[model samples]
Structure formats: C-alpha cells, structure tokens
Target chain A: EADIYQTPRYLVIGTGKKITLECSQTMGHDKMYWYQQDPGMELHLIHYSYGVNSTEKGDLSSESTVSRIRTEHFPLTLESARPSHTSQYLCASSGTYNEQFFGPGTRLTVL
Target chain B: GESVGLHLPTLSVQEGDNSIINCAYSNSASDYFIWYKQESGKGPQFIIDIRSNMDKRQGQRVTVLLNKTVKHLSLQIAATQPGDSAVYFCAESRGFQKLVFGTGTRLLVSP
Candidate 1:
C-alpha cells in the first residue's frame, strides 16, 4: 500500500544530543512538509520541500533543518536538541492542492 | 498574516449524536480547504476537502461546509462514535502547497 512512514515513533534523548527524524512517502509526492505540534495544540509548520534538493523554512522559525535527497524521503535533523524541542513531529506529503497524507509522527522528548 | 482559528477549543458529545465543529479563516484569497482528524499519539488524517467554488461536500458520515463570503468552514459528523473522538482541524491553501492549519477542536464522545 502507498503511505507515508516515520521512523523512531518515540525518542528520548539528552539535551545537546544530535537527533534525526526520518520520513518517507511511497506515493511519489513532490511536496513534503514537516510540522511541530505540542500536545493538544495546533500544528506549526517548520519546514517544507517543493521538490528534490529544495527546502524552505515555514512560518514558525525552527532550529531544525530538513533535506529532500529523493522524492520519497525527507529527513529532519536537530544539531543540538533542547528540552523545548520536545514535541511531536509530523511529516506530510501532497501531490497538488488536494488533501495531504500524514505519517504516523515521531514523538521526541529531549531530557 | 492570515490566520485560521476554531470556534471552540473542545467539544463533548454523546455517542450516536451529531457533532459539529466550526473554523474561520482570515484569507478570502484561499482557494482550498481541508478537514483533518487527529487522534492522540498520531498524525492528522484527511477527513474531507472543499474548494472555494463549492459550498459543501460530503464523505462517509461526514460533511464539510465552506463559506467564502465569511471565510468560515464547518465539519459535521453524523452518529458520532468513540472512534470519532479526536482533534479536528481545518486547513487553508491559497496558491502554494503550504497549508495553514487552524488551532483545532478536541472532540470527546461519551457512551
């Protein structure tokens, strides 16, 4: 089945540690996005990629960076994690203006 | 600075009852809108979508109503069930694939 996937569903790392969240989509979508969401709060876009080798920062300034090496893969990396960085990270992909499909999400906890 | 917001932060409804969630956007230029249902510890799932040219659209036991004049949107769930309990959010897209999401309304269904 064609779907989006995220690895490390839950992560607990110490502060200052480097961590990467992996996201992959099998639907061959060119547009991918990363969103940060606090528990029970609204999702805030952190990064997005329009196509291969393209990335942009979203409305909410983020300390993380993302890369799109392939159409199906978009990974986010935090050079130095902090406790404030602890939140759920969701990945999504879309083909056009239609609905977007989201990954299961990665819950990160920086202790 | 077009922001999307929800009318209610949370809603509680009995099982088998109808549930309604409302959203409002500040951008009239938005061309598309979507409703997403997100359960705890998971990502948002696409529920329904509506274009600016349309007023209403329906899906399995769900309906989405869009009003461009007032920049308002609504999602109605028929015969609400426990599985339907989640956070519902409305997203708006203008030209780019970037979707701006609303604050979200938590739906709690009681048996």
Candidate 2:
C-alpha cells in the first residue's frame, strides 16, 4: 500500500470559512500534487510541488494555495472556502518515474 | 489545449469475463500513461502503467495497451469480479510533468 495520507476524510463548513487540508507522505517522494475532482468527473490538477520551497500552479486555476516546506508534507489551504469549492480534494506523491500514488482524499462540503 | 477523454461513460460486464476500458488523449507528446482504479469513498489506486516505448504491459490480472499511432490507451482486466467494480481512469503525462486525466469509465461487474 501507498504511504500517502490525508486528514479529515470529510469536512463540512460554512461559506467564507478558512480551511486547511493536510497531506503527508512517508515515501520520501520529491513531487507532490493536489487535484480537485467532482462526482463522476475527471480529476483536475490544482497545485503541485517539486521538493521543498518549489511550488507551481497546475493546469486548473484554483483559489487554494500550497506550501512545500518539507519533502513529505504538502498542505493546501483555502483562504475563504466557497460553495463552488465543494468537491473532493486528492493528494498524491510521485517519484522520478511520474507514477503518482494517491491518498484517500478529503471530501469537502461548503454549506 | 489538449485533453484526455473516454469513449464510454460506463461499462457493464459479467463476473469471470474480460473487461476493457478505452481512453483517447489529444496530446501526442505524452510519453507515460497510467491506469487508476477509484472505489467509492476512496482514493484512486494505481493499477498499471505503460511507457510510450512499450506497446503493452501486464500486471497480475491487468494489462495496459498503448497505441501511440491513434493516441489511444486501454486497460484489460481478466476474470472480472464484483470487487473490480469501480471507476477506471487513464492518465497521460509528457516526461515528468503533471498528468492529464481522462474522464473516468465506471465499471459495473455483476454476478
């Protein structure tokens, strides 16, 4: 099994509340990624990091921000969560080969 | 603006039969491809992957076929079981960049 893990598998909050989704991996992978997926839809890359202090925006524009202070941790934070952000947030880590191993995912619901 | 997509939204198969899921990618530059299986309320699990240099790769009871000429990818599962019911996604990446995921195909296996 993959060593990637995500906290708070489910979250529900009101609009405008700030929230942080935690992601961590024990595989010592340098590349970490965050993806947003809706029900019955494909995953869209929102953010990614290539080792410590190296972060980049993904193909999809997202309001959340990510920080990669440590090689194993890549957390995503939403300054002001909106109803539109109600979806599944998946965290993944990959090695040099680019085959990603995903976490269990955090399902967010902005009421 | 390139994208990956699936020809079928859903596929129904009988138990003990073979199942195939197809995907098409618009970017011919993609060099690596992977297949993921996502069960309900869980993260996507890495199933198998095939590099552009290879036309076919097999793992356990799963096989991945890549056809660069038509920009097509496929996953074949032998002896489909009820436990194999899930959403199957195909992802493509060029080099070490972020992956582009195709709209998943839901596999329904019935006894």
Candidate 3:
C-alpha cells in the first residue's frame, strides 16, 4: 500500500470548533496535495505544496488552510468548523511524472 | 480554464466482461494523465498512468489508452471482476504540477 497516512479516519465536531486534519507521507515526496470530495462528486483540489514552506491555493476556493513545515507532513486546518465543511478530505503525494498515492481519507461531519 | 471530465457519471458492467471508461480534457498542454479507483468510505487508489508520449499502457488487469490528438483518454479493464467496482477518476497534469481531476465514474460490477 501507499506510505501516506491521515489521522482520525472519521471526525465529528460541533460548529465553531477548530479542527486540524493531519496528513503525512513517508515516501519523502516533494509534491503533496489536499483534496475535498463530496459524495458522488469529483475530487476538488483545495491546497497543494511543492516543498517545505511552499504552499499554494488550488483551483477551488476553500476556507481550510494548510501548512508544510516539514517535508513529510502537510496539515490542513479550519479556523472554525461549519456544517458546510462536512466532506471527505484526501491527502496525496507524488513523485515526478508518476501517479499520486492517496491516504485513507478523513470523513468530516460538522454538527 | 483547464479541467478534466468524464463522459458518463456511472457505468455498470457484468462480471467477466470488459469495461471501458472514457474521460476528456480541455487542456492540450497537459502531458501526463493518471486513473484512480476509489471505493466507498476510502481514498482514491492509483490504477494506471499514461504520459503524452505514449498511447497505451497496461497494468495487471487495467489498460489506459490515451488519444492525444483528441485530448481523450480511456481506461479498459480486461475481464472485469466484482472487486473492480469503484468510482474511477481521470486526472491530468502539466509538467508534474498540480493535477486537475475529472468528474468521477461510478463503476458497478455485478456478479
């Protein structure tokens, strides 16, 4: 399987609560990405990083933010959770010209 | 804007039958493409990949065909099995940068 991992495979939280979704890869890939997917819909790229200290917003507008302080870690945070934020968050890492390896994903439910 | 899309939203196949899923892209600049399989409540899994230079690539049971002239891609599964049921996505990327994912195709392999 892929070396990528995400914490809290499922999460349920009340509105206005702060939450962080964790993602890490042991492959030491320079490229990492975070995608949001709703049921029966396509995956949306929310945030991506080329390397440490390098992060960029994806095509979709998202309230969630991400940080890449370490090469193997990319964490997505929400200032305050909302009901609209309920969805599955996927983490992926890739090497040059190769396919991405994805984590198990975190299913978030904001109450 | 560049984006990827699937021709159909859902595809149902019988066991032992061959299956084909088609995808289209708006960006000719994208030279790399990858196919992913995602089951319910799980993250997407890498299936196959094809670069612009190649027209076809094959894995164990899956084959990806790329038609650069038409900016179209297709995934063919030989002798599809029930375990092959999942949502399939085709993604495109230019120069190993951020990828644009296509609308997903839910594959139902009935036994």
Candidate 4:
C-alpha cells in the first residue's frame, strides 16, 4: 500500500472560511502533486512541487496555494473557501518513473 | 493545448470476463502513460503504466497497451471481478513532467 495520507477525509465549512488540507507521504518522493476532482469527473491538476521550496501551478486554475517546506509534506490552503471550491482534493507522490501514488482524498463542501 | 480523453464514459462488464478501457491523447510528445483506478469515496490508485518505448506491459491480471502511432492507450483487466468496479483513468506525461489526466471511464462489473 502507498504511504501517502490526507487528513479530514471530509470537510464542510461556510463560505469565506480559510481551510488547509493536509497531505503527507513517507515514501521520500521528490514530486508531490495536488489535484481537484468532481464527483465522477476527470481530475485536474492544481498545484505541484518538485522538491522542497519548489512549487509550480498546474494546468487548471485554482485559488488554493501550496507550500513544500519539507519533502514529506505538501499542504494546500484556500484563503477564502467558496462554494465553487468545493470538490475532492487529492494528494499524490511520485518517483522517477512518474507512477503517482495517491492518498485517500479529502472531500470538501462549502456551504 | 494538449488533453487526454476517453472514448467511453462508462463501460459495463460481467464477472469473469475480460474488460478493456480506452483513452486517446492529443499530445504525441507524451512519453509515459499510466492507468489509475479510483473507487467511490477514495483516492485514485496506481494500476499500471507503460513507457513510449514499449508497446505493452503487464501486471498481475492487468495489462497496459500503448499505440504511439495513434496516440492511444488501453487498459485490460482479466477475469473482471466485483472488486474491479470503479472509475478507470489514463494519464500521459512528457519527459517525466506533470501528467495530463483523461476523463475517467466508470467500470461496472456485474455478477
């Protein structure tokens, strides 16, 4: 099984609340990624980090920001969560071959 | 812009039969391809992968076929079981960079 983990498998909050979704991996992978997926829809990459202090935006535009201060941790934060930001946030880690191991996603609901 | 997509949004198969899910990518430059399985209320799990250099790769009861000529990729599952019912996604990446995930195909396996 993959060593990746995500906290608060489900979250519900009001609009304008600041929320942080936690992601961590024990695999010592240099590549970490965050993807947003709707129910039964395709996943869209929102943010990624090559290594510590290296972060980049992904194909989809997202209001969330990510920080990679440590190799094992890559957390995504939404400054002001809105209803549109409500979706499943998935965290993944990958090695050289690029086969990503994903964590059990965090499903967010902004009421 | 490059994108990956699936031909069928949903596939229905019977238990103990073979199942095939197809995907097409617009970017010919993508060198690595991977298949992922996502169950309801869970993150996507890595299933199998294939590099552009090879045409086929196999895992336990699962096979990945790549046809670079048509920029097509496929996942084959042998003796489909109830446990195999989930959403299957194909992702492509170029030079080990970020991946472009295709719209998933839901696999419904019935007894």
- Tell me model 2's lDDT, rounded to 2 decimals: 0.91
Candidate 1: CAPRI quality band: acceptable
Which has the greatest TM-score? 1
| Model 2 iRMS | 6.0
Give the DockQ (C-alpha) for candidate 3. 0.40
Question: In model 3, what is the error at residue B104, expressed in angstroms?
Answer: 1.3
Per-residue lDDT of model 1, residues B48-71, tens digit only: 988888999999999999888888
Q: lDDT tens string, model 2, A68-100?
A: 999999999999998888989999999988889
Candidate 1 global TM-score: 0.94
Candidate 1 residue-pair clash tally: 0
Against the true two-chain complex, what DockQ does each candidate achieve? Answer: 0.41, 0.43, 0.40, 0.44
Q: Is the docking of candidate 4 incorrect, acceptable, medium or high quality?
A: acceptable
Clashes of 2: 0
Off by over 4 Å in 3: B1-8
- Where model 2 places Cα greater than 4 Å from the true spot, the runs are B1-8
lDDT of 3 by residue, B2-110 (tens): 2322244889999999999999987999989999999988999888888899999999988999998899999999999999999999999898667788888999999
Model 1 misses residue B11 by how many Å?
0.7
True contacts kept of 2: 0.48
Mark the regions of model 1 whose C-alpha exceeds 4 Å error after superposition.
Answer: B1-8
- lDDT at position A69, candidate 4: 98
DockQ-best of 2 and 3: 2
